[model samples]
Target: MISKWNILTRRKMRGVYIIAVFTTILLGLASRKFSHLLIPFIANNAGDFIWAMMVYFGFRFLFVHKGLLFAILLSFLFSFGIEFSQFYQADWMNQIRETLLGALILGKGFLTVDLIRYTAGILIAAVFDKRYSS
Candidate 1:
């Protein structure tokens, strides 16, 4: 029998997953390319939004039956976990942060304001997902 986790693996949501992937990439590139044009608030926190969406999409793509609130919660928990991880500052962790990908994923520093950005991103993602799913 098919399970809830198997829902996302089916072809029905392929388009949703593809769109999420593209949107995530576009947001990431746009954040970098237009950083100069954006205000400090947007420029500094845009990545948090993208990160939240990435996590949201990831959960929707895996646990397709899960609800919007679930996605939002999972994304926030994960983003917060990663942001909090920045406080470790161990030698190995710092070494990882030195790399481009690592820095992008783990972040160089912790900012409390980032939590808001992550929430906004997940909420936006949930809205979009609800719209598209219907």
Candidate 2:
């Protein structure tokens, strides 16, 4: 029942989201790798902020049909949930955290500041998406 234009728009949006996710990931990695060259505040916080932006883009890619508010809420829930999950110190979880991939995904430890970084990142992403996606 969808029009051809709607289908094309969805595909285009998905592609945009995919690119945003990868770009954010690269920036996050670069922030960590090149932290010594940057300001101390950005060096410490950019990775987390970029990580949250990547999460928002990823949800947008997956839920391309959903409204911007839906993506915003879902991204916030997901990012915050992952941050909170770090408080669980079960042996199995710790084992997973030990791996490089798991460490990147789940993070090594919970920091209160990460929540602020995530909130800012998500809000900024939503603002950009709202402004540019139309």
Candidate 2, residues 13-99, lDDT tens digits: the string is: 999999999999999999999999999999999999999999999999999999989999998899999999999999999999999
Error of 2 at 60 (Å): 0.5
RMSD of each: 2.9, 0.8
**Top candidate (TM-score):** 2
lDDT (Cα, 0-100) at 85 in candidate 1? 96
**Best model number under lDDT:** 2
Q: For residues 1-134, what per-residue lDDT tens digits would candidate 1 score against the true structure?
A: 87866664555776676679678968976997799999998898787788788788888877666677877788888899999998899999999999988987898999988888888888888898889787
Model 2 lDDT-worst window of ten: 100-109
List of clashing residue pairs for candidate 2 = none
Q: What lDDT score belongs to each candidate, Candidate 1 first? A: 0.82, 0.94
Lowest lDDT block of 10, candidate 1: 6-15
TM-scores for the candidates: 0.83, 0.97
- Residue 129's lDDT in candidate 1: 85
